[model samples]
Target: MSLVIDIHTHPAFFEAINADEERLHLRQTCLGLYKTGAAPLAHIFNQMKYAGIDRLGLLPLDLTTTHGVELVSNAEIHHLVSLAPEKFIGFASVDPRRKDAVEVLEYAFGELKLSGLKLHPAKQKFYPMDEGLDAVYACCLRHNKPILFHAGISLQPDAPSQYARPEHFEAVALRYPRLRMCLGHFGWPWVVETAALLLKYPNVYADTGLLYFDSAREFYQHVFTRTLGQHWVDRSLRHQVLFGSNNPRFEQIRMVEALHTLGWRASTLELVLGGNALEFLG
Candidate 1:
């Protein structure tokens, strides 16, 4: 098998949170994750070994301004990466609405050595095309860091779906053609719109972190085969698709199995699994 990478994972439930109350707070804030347990960091490594995932992108969510909390701090993510640098890729999150958002990003990219940025428009209650975020976008462009966005529906109780619609990102893509951005979860149920962005902008990408209903295989079949054409990924956007499990909400092992069962060419599978992610992270 080619090197597999799960590009969307929230490490909020790791053992770093020693207190039970803190863990409960994290679970409540991250909504729709009622059954996931806080486990030791080694548990993630074991899961990766079983799932054939060679590496993982550790994404933290900074909701300081809106939620008055950080799901997992950049410093925490940096600590995790320091423990296992070869297996973990860290991405920093900042409340773009903050006045010093650009400065925070610069420190994350330059000092913390985080690879990219992760943002959630719905949870943060901000529009993707808002002029307020131009500085954050410019900072990312200057540092050559990719931004991974939660572009579809969000499960947070206070999260508004209106903020995450795929079309809202069009302006960002058009304005910053040099900045690389990914709409995570394939932007479903707006998969077609997400695919349109992928087809139109070389700088835009999407990840297969979608597992909203049924089994992973069933959901993926419905989205990829029925919604988008069967060959759309391999033929039209092979290099732009990244495999993401959105772990704990879903399982990396099951998603990997589901993607392999889709009947895509071996080369296409390789790209979606890891090759495309490498290019996106560049």
Candidate 2:
């Protein structure tokens, strides 16, 4: 089996939230998650074991400027990675709208030793092409870090989907051709546009984190087979697609099983499930 890596996961609910009230508040306000209670570390390990996931790319959302909260702080991610450095790949989050955003990213990369950067244009309320973010983008490029952008729909209240459209990232891609980036959730509902970007830019990629309606298998069939054409990934974008479960919102096991049902070739599955992520992270 190829090394399996889940490239999209929010670990805020797993051993990150301390107080029940805090967890509840985050669930309601920041995360839009109804699932109550914090999951112990063991629960996540068990889930990974059952799902055949070798590592998790833990993502944090720094919504301090827009929502006055850090969905999961950089420090907390560092702590979680510290607990099991071999099992977790920590990504840093910074509010790009802040004047100190570049500085914060510097600390995250230099001091915390995070692997990459995760940003949410919809939740952060910033345009991907905004000049204000030039410094932040430069910082990531300077550190040779890839970025995972929250593309497409957002479950959080007040997070508009318009800001995360796949087209909005073209300019950034054009400017920083060397900086690798993944459009999270496959830019669902605009899957074609996402595919276009992936085709046009070598540095651009997408992840299979979308689960909007119905069973995972059904949804993936609709998106990957009917909507995007059955052989699109296997034929064209195998090297650019990464396996992402968007866990905490959806179960990793379900997404993994659903992806397997897509009828892709073994080589294609190897790329999507792990090989592609390894390249993206580099």
Best model per lDDT? 2
How many backbone overlaps does candidate 2 show? 0
Candidate 1 residue lDDT tens string, 1-282: 677889999887887653567656666556657766777878889999999999999998888898777778899899989989999999999999887788889999999999999999998999999999999999998999999999889876888889999999999999999999999999988999999999999999999999989998898898988889999998989999999989878767989999988879999999999999999999
CA lDDT, every model vs. true structure: 0.90, 0.91
Positional deviation of residue 179's Cα in model 2 after best superposition, in angstroms: 0.9
Per-residue error for 176 in candidate 1, Å, reads: 0.7
Q: Name the lDDT value of residue 226 in candidate 2.
A: 94
- Cα RMSD (Å) per model? 1.2, 1.1
TM-score of 1: 0.97
TM-score of each: 0.97, 0.97
Candidate 2 stretches greater than 4 Å from native = none
Candidate 1: segments with Cα more than 4 A from true spot: 17-20
